[model samples]
Target: MTSEADLAWIASVVGDPARLRILLSLMDGRARTAKELAFLARIAAPTASGHLAKLLDSRLVAVEPQGRHRYFRIASPLVAQMVETMSAVAGDASPGDRRLRRIDPALAAARTCYDHLAGRLGVAIADALQARGHVAFGDGSGEVTASGRAFFAALGLDLAEAGHGRRVFCKPCLDWTERRHHIAGGLGAAFCGHCLSAGWIRRHRDSRAVEVSPEGRVALAELLGVDGQALTSGWPERAAA
Candidate 1:
């Protein structure tokens, strides 16, 4: 039930460059404080607050209060999907010649998709899951075969245990960098957890960039039946996270 007037107002709200940056910064689905978002968007706190207020009114963003801190995130998964899809398209369209630190050549290998794993590792795992016939669905409500469940269990990633009554399990998260799709949802988080615990990958010292090690290459091959090293060779090794 969206009124034309409301839509018009939202259009205005998202039209500003600063607000657009803020919205894009939150696409990874992580709740962020105004100051954090402001730093990411390179805007002032008051300005970020103003944009957040407008986004909140549009229902494009939601806020949570934690003691003295208030945090904001995209209003819903639908919003996250929309932002990711749009960012993917926009990033492709505007392949700037300038070399930015964030746009490293290795972005595809390991990076953050909001808060979870994304990039080449993300894309390949997503593709392999679908290719292996383990997942059969689009962005939500996927069905995983029993063998698929067992296969992951061998990797120390039991979906039942990893899922642990959280968000939807075995769902697809459309890739913003690859323009394809990646496994997301509870299952996705579980898989990510397994990778982390296995010493296969490590988050960059301070950045969202993820680096795969020699061990990760061996582990991903043994666990996922796909050679992580092979897939990332000459590919965008540094895909966004």
Candidate 2:
């Protein structure tokens, strides 16, 4: 049985409204400075920090030091996976197929936290990979295809070199928004890094939402075989070039 102290630890952190907002903010899969998180959560800077501190203490979030800037992010993708999975079960759910319909709405577009996929970006990436034959879902897991090997090589990622054992290579994460599976695991982390390094995407102010550059669109298409122009018609023209 779970101990009361364990329950208390979780309760102390999660029962908070602002802290919860902070977690939601990080769902975009990008690292954010504390000031940006404060704005995103609509809390004062000090309050945001304190709440973030509590989350950090609980291992629900992590920090990155970039020169003078200190950025906060979800501690790990496991946190996102746990939160999303719990959300899927709805806590009050019964043992049945009724669980299939629950979906997080905002995730249908793009969102993430720290170093992993979240929201719509997560959902779409997973879909595109599967659709284009780079991946396939089976046997309670996913596998990278031969096509995926060439695909990653083009982006300059060699997952084989990223190391083996004690790390998941490819895994499906449930998208909170679209109620579908998206790619997670080591491969997902690598993809996010590639996007950032290539300047194909950027984070918005005070939100986990990602803005895909027009160039990013073209880059994604070139890299992942996605149709950049067709995928996002509303992206400004300059970025698309």
Identify the candidate with maximal TM-score: 1
The clash count of every prediction, one per candidate, is: 13, 14
Candidate 2 wrongly placed segments (more than 4 Å): 1-108, 163-165, 229-241
- Model 1 local distance difference test score: 0.69
Cα TM-score of candidate 2: 0.49
Question: Against the hidden reference, what TM-scores do the models get?
Answer: 0.53, 0.49
Q: Give me the runs in candidate 1 sitting further than 4 Å from their true place.
A: 1-102, 234-241
Candidate 1 lDDT, tens digit per residue, 110-226?
786765688767877766666677676632357678778777777677677756775677766655555445777777877777777878888888777788878888867666566
